[model samples]
Target: MIPAKADIEAAYARVKPYVHRTPVLTSSLINKHINAEVFFKCENFQKMGAFKMRGAVNAILQLSEEERKAGVVTHSSGNFAQAVALAARTLGVQAYIVMPSNAPGVKKEAVKGYGGIITESLPSLEDRERAAVEIKRETGATFLHPSNQMEVILGNATATLELLESHPDLDTVITPVGGGGLLAGTALAVHYFGNRCMTIAGEPFAADDAYRSFHAGQIETNTTAITIADGLRTQLGSVNFPIIKELVTDILRVEEAEIVDSMRYLWERLKIVIEPSSAVPFAALLRHKEQFRNKKIGILLSGGNVSLSQLPF
Candidate 1:
């Protein structure tokens, strides 16, 4: 179910103590090049190096005392794995994470650092979910899907809620659509918070299910996700798809090279270290510059958990 406006506000309040109020930033150079005033909500600096922390914390905190005692479990390729681990540790609950064997070493290490018991699975979403189900059955831990749960969606909205609070007049907001959680939350936030501000999602051409889903008016899954933006690889969820189809203004696709160039541009120009997934929306904005001409737009720089050793550049 879609969260009410009050639920989004309450979510902000609930996660406020646990999460960082990430800064809203801008680049004069980016503005000149795109001919639009762009505000970068730097969630790369968020706790766990991503916005997933907001959802992770909110979902875990909503569990009953009995549920928390049994602990929580999730499947993720990276950021959400670290988020649940760290949030569970901070809240004094055990977390068991089923992570793909091929997940980035940096993220796997972070999950361990946060005291999550790790289960290795094959490098497919299906395998990851299966492993998580096994862990949940064995440990009696609650399963927290990274993007589908309603509580998680409400939590993800807080990031854009903060963005809208800071810039109430934003003409549009863009997010990289992976599992559709963030984009759904952003759309809901814009609907309830913004003054006619629209929502758009940037997606990789390689894993463009969200794009196809939006146009085809149904949920679509990718057989193979081969993009450098690791975080933007998951398919849309049932819980968020209805919200997205109704509220999102458009979905734009960008090539892999464009994703890389946009990432490098942010690195050099914004002088902020952002992961490739964080740059997809920026690439979309630049690619469709004519649409945003002179408008005030906001882009959420999603995360910064890249391993410097493996950068494409």
Candidate 2:
């Protein structure tokens, strides 16, 4: 079963000692352009530069003494990799990370900085998973799914929980969907905390598995992950999909150009750095601006871990 409201509340309390209560910021210019008030949950300012820290911390905190002794392992392209590594380090647990070779060098460096033992894999979901499984089997470490684990989902919800606490009047929440962890968790947060707020997801058109999965009423896989939003390349998983399919209002997708332009657009206006993945939701909001007319919107700026050399600008 999906996590109940009490479960999410408890997770928030459990994570407080480990994570930051990130601020929810608003831009009047963005509101003017979209014809609606918008609140940006600045998880980009989060520790390790992403919301994945919340989940990774929660997932590790709940582990038994024996599990912690064996350490933790996961496979992620960027944000979650850094999150897991940092969380494990914070808790004095060994972290075995399987990362795709094509992941940003900055992220790879961050993982190493957090003391994660890295096993490089070819840039594919299969290779990443295989490497993680091998490490888990070899070291007897507990494997934490970057997005599919229930503990991770509940941990992810704390971001939106904090958002609704700051701005309770929001009518809609927009999340960038990658494997549905944050989207599913955000939907649950709105369901439990918001005053009838609806949840939507923004995805890259090139890696539109979540968008396709939402409409098709089933899980879909992307054969090719060629988008600039490197963080959102993963596919939806069984654990988060049910909550997403039921509670999320829609999945809005944008093209590569929109993603890059919106990334820079917010950078210029908000004067804050956000990755291309963070810009997807803003692009979708502007693309479908008419749908949210007069609505108060909440967008989660997922992360800010970009390689300086690989700036898409």
Candidate 3:
């Protein structure tokens, strides 16, 4: 069942002590460029340096004492891995993370630093799932689907809820679509509490399953998501797809070069470090600037977990 606005509020209260209430930042330069007043909800400054921490904490808090003792397991490429690890550690629960062998070294190190037991898998979704299952079997850990669980979705919605609460007059809110947890949650928050605000998603053209899924009225997949927005490489799961389809106004697709340009602009203009996935929404706004002129917009900056050694710019 889809979680309601009350569920998101409960989650916010549950996780409020654990997660950071990240600030909403404004960029006058960016506003000038888009001709709109834009508020950036800086989840890049969140715990574990990503918005994933909110969901991780909420899911962990939902576990029973026995389940907490048995621990939790999930497969993720980066941000969610660190989130689960950190959340579990904070709650005195064990965490097993199945990460792609090709995941960025910095992310892997962060997971390990958070006391996660790491099991490496091939960079395929199938392999990661298989490895997570094996870990659950071996350790009796409860498996958590990183983005598809109700608790996770509602937890993610709190970020948008906080944004809208602070900026009640925003005309629109945008977030990058990966597995669609954040977008689905944002849509729900806007539906329940916003002042006639619309929810939209920005996604990579190279990994555009969410965009396609929005139109197809069902989940979609990309054979290979070769985008620099690594956090957005995964396909939307069943749990998030329906919510996204029903509430999101549209999914805007941006090219890779545009992603890089937007990332650079945020770094240089706003003086804030944001990953490529975070840049997708801003890139989409830049691509369709005419549509949002003079409107107040909120953009969720999803993460800052980038590898300095391999800077895309």
Error of 3 at 244 (Å): 0.7
lDDT of 3: 0.93
Q: Lowest lDDT 10-mer window, candidate 3?
A: 1-10
RMSD of each: 0.7, 0.7, 0.7
The order by descending lDDT is: 1, 2, 3
Model 1 TM-score is: 0.99
Q: What do the candidate models score in CA lDDT, each in turn?
A: 0.94, 0.94, 0.93
* lDDT score for residue 107 of model 3: 96
What lDDT does model 1 reach?
A: 0.94
- Count clashing residue pairs in model 3: 0
lDDT of 2 at 117: 97
TM-score of 2: 0.99
Q: Model 3: per-residue lDDT, tens digit, 214-236?
A: 89898889999999999998988
Cα deviation in Å at residue 284, candidate 1? 0.2
